[model samples]
Target: MLTRDEVFAVLQTVPDPEVPVISVVELGVVRDVDITPDGVTVTMTPTYSGCPAMREMEADVKAALLARGVRNVTVRMTLSPAWTTDWIGEEAREKLRRYGIAPPGRADQGGFVTLTRARPAVACPFCGSTDTVLQSEFGSTACKAIHSCRACGSPFDEFKAL
Candidate 1:
């Protein structure tokens, strides 16, 4: 039987399909790991309710565990608490920056909806400058936005805070 830590170690090897540089664990999606004599269950939360990469992520998690000799593996997803960028650790944030994607800032917890919320200026990942312009509200994915850095004249993606 595999221990919880062992399962997590295996899970850490599974990278997110969208963000290949970071593992699902580093993305803060792997919420819990439960082990039993019969099988292993992994609980996860998607970055959003309708994230397209979630199916791939779940498959990767199960495949990773199965490769480790586990006969049966289960991936359970929960949306009760939802997913937040705040779950992302500082180290993972730095990894995102190194990958040329601006890490998300603190998530807005105002609990009120506004038509137009003032978005903070995101620092450039390449030149480390705050002189960045929002090129588009949508990027390659829904959770990201497109931006251009004035200092480096480079276009990059900014992971939106949720």
Candidate 2:
């Protein structure tokens, strides 16, 4: 029988398919773990409702747990609480920075909508410069934005705040 802690430990080894530098657990995708006599169930919340990586992430979790000798594995996704960038830990943010992707800043929780809001400058992950310009609102994925650093002339992705 696998303890809850042991299950989580195994999940920590399951890296995110999109962000290989960080585990799915580190990305705050795994919401809860339930162990039963019949099987183990993992509850997950996608970074966004339509995130394309959700299926891959669920498959990886199942495969990882199965490889660990678990007989049955179930992945349940919930969208009620909706994933937030604020769920990302400080250590994970540093890892993203080291991986050349600018980590997201605090998410805006203001309920009001504003069309004239100026976009904040994203710091360059490679050169640590605030003199970065947004090359495109969309990056390799919808969850990230493309930015170019004026200081080092490096193009990098910024994990957009949800």
| Best prediction by lDDT | 2
Task: Check candidate 2 and list the clashing pairs.
Answer: none
Give per-residue lDDT, candidate 2, residue 126.
Answer: 98
Runs in model 2 deviating more than 4 A are 110-116
* Residue 52 CA displacement from its true place in model 2, Å: 1.0
Task: Report the lDDT tens digits of candidate 1 across residue range 12-99.
Answer: 8998898888899999999999898989999999998899999999999989998989999999999968788888899989999999
In terms of TM-score, which candidate is strongest? 1
Tell me, what's the RMSD of every candidate? 1.3, 1.6
Question: lDDT per prediction?
Answer: 0.91, 0.92
Candidate 1 clashing pairs?
A: none
Clashes of each: 0, 0
lDDT of 2 by residue, 21-53 (tens): 999999999999999999999999999889999
Q: Among all windows of ten consecutive residues in candidate 1, which has the lowest summed lDDT?
A: 108-117
